[model samples]
Target: MFSLKKSQMFALIISSLIVGYTTTMINAKADSGYTVVKRMTGNNANVAYHLANNSKNTYLWNGIHTKAKANLRKYKNYSWRYYGKSLILSHNSKKSLYYYIQGITPNGNEASKIRGIVWHSYLTPGINPNYKQLNNIYYRYFNTDSEYLHYVQKSPSQKLTREVLKLFPNTHLSIQLTKAADGASPWAWASPRVDGYKNILEFPTVQKYFNKRFYKPNISDNTRFKLIKAGLDKSYSQTKRNALTQYQIGIYYYNNPHRLIDDEAPGFTIAIPE
Candidate 1:
């Protein structure tokens, strides 16, 4: 039998309530696993993903990270309608929520229509509006790094809205450039990454740019294209290049606001939509 004083009993009850609340939150976030999914507009994309990898391929799979069914790059600019969502367990037992979607065209070529699964991130409408290459920023990379562009941005404020940021990958950003001169102010750098794209695609008002390798704007304006910064283009050491080339998509992200491997990497901000 268990017994407790009045104060002790009150404390015990408080602890139990806290634990229950935490468990509810945790359970709410747990993956809901199912194969078939319902169709939804929110999961849809107004434009197709850019296949910016050296391979120039954006693959859709038979299932979550499963067999490749088709390449969306062939149908560039096409819109996608989302079917639903499903949590899939990879070989490592990691859960990746994938969108089951199909490409649409005005022609409606049923036979040529592409249908498959892809990460929701891949279906972003397009690059962030704020991401653009600066004329004076330093270009950081080798000829081998053509798959993705890298650069450094120096600014007193890291409050990013529609502003473009150039983050580097594989190498340490500090070695390539000097730190804040007088005192530390927010700065950011962009480079390719080995993991899934770290840029929070859903981040409100954050800007992005199209990787020239896989992106061609619907319009003929060359100004929309992202260009390499004006200085420095040295090849990385063999080890660094190997790691940076892990994914064909070339996940480029930032090197500041250090915390979890998140959009906070360099200059991504949490701004309210106007």
Candidate 2:
């Protein structure tokens, strides 16, 4: 629901262009024989080399948090959501062999952490798949400490698009832009109208509770409430408010935007995609 001002949008566009240009330069300078796979397509020399070198290695299966595992198993049994064969699940440390061999990290210590799983053509096609399963599992399994769960090595933006296409071809993907300074936590406080308790609310609940409480005239609390209501009403129409609420729910349920843990630690469910 946080919007970027004109200046901020301009800056971000410029920065993205710079990054794209830099990536092109880096690829050009690489060794002559190297086949540079576009990072956005998840086809890179590094990913190809890893797959080729580690074809024989065994991958460990690290099941999602208890809840997510149950859900996945149930889905596997009942729903025909997954296509192709499921790859062996493994703990990140065990998977370190592939990354280490690829020279992604210098040592096991550096490699042993939560990372997106890269999928092969058999499981997924087009670009390198940076698996979000781990992040989802961590949020579900360890709900309270989900905020502390940090993912390492995000897939590049271009590769991310290809990965999405591999999973859901012909889908129209919409990016809902929000301000960078909105903080990772989606829920924030509106200044309190009540004297003692803080008027804390999640984005979805904001509209439902808007302007419901009446503060006494001449009190500063009343003035603050008016200001807040004006801001919310002015910035977001009812339809836009609904959309933003849905977006927040997506963040909470799937992406774990604030990384809140649910009943099961490291559990995951398909978030309702925007």
Candidate 3:
């Protein structure tokens, strides 16, 4: 019979118990949290899928294509992990596909380029206006106007154009207003100085000017400072904030739904089963 010292035996038993408990706890925690669902390369699917699937109601940043692809491999085939309200996807690729989602009313023609294409036109039912020609028009008008000709000469619109290009670099601004009830005449009065064109100016040119200027660099230091300043001053209005919040919430929920769950971690794990 082998006789072991009481103190030594007791210590061994306690150490074994502690090890067991720690292992159990770690495993339990790992099992209780979120799970990864699908992972794929850029060659597999579009970013829209992930945006449409996340449950944390988070927004995607602009230019997230590489991150999305890296995430594909990191969380391959529905693994389990802990993710808070959001997960950051990262990648090493040069091409990124993240974009800001926006909804345009059929008749809002603030952006000259998008006016004919994206604005409410009979030709395209739900399309928003394109800004290509409007951009060209800006340059054209800038060149022709003595007051703004300096902008045209220096291509002040370049910064704004680059910003717009970020949204859709390849987008074509080819839509024509020829289909309007007034035909091409609706577009003939693109300039405010042109008389008898007040009907076509129903849409605010100031709004369009701001829209174009929004894409420009150092807009605050440039021609649009006054308008932007004025808008910012009024942005605190309850009505405006409420509307903005509502829109943000709608977008958040739309992008993140309950049905899309990480396979490893389920929604039930986060919220107590009620």
Q: How do the residues 52-101 of candidate 3 rate in per-residue lDDT, one tens digit apiece?
A: 22232232122222111111211111111111112223333222222222
lDDT of each: 0.35, 0.25, 0.24
lDDT of 2: 0.25
TM per prediction: 0.26, 0.19, 0.17
In model 3, which runs have C-alpha deviations exceeding 4 angstroms? 1-50, 55-69, 72-188, 191-208, 211-216, 221-274
Candidate with more favorable, higher TM-score: 1 or 2: 1
Model 1 Cα lDDT, one tens digit per residue, 1-274: 2555877898999999999988855553343443433333344232323333313556677753435666676665344555544344444445455666665442222233578776665665422112132211111221123211322232212212112322223322221122111011123324222222242122211223222222332422223322221111223233433353222221222222112122122222211112
Worst 10 residues of 1 by lDDT: 176-185
- Candidate that would win on lDDT: 1
Native-to-model Cα distance after best TM-score fit, residue 38 in candidate 2, in Å? 26
> Is candidate 1 or 3 superior in TM-score?
1
- Models ranked on lDDT: 1, 2, 3
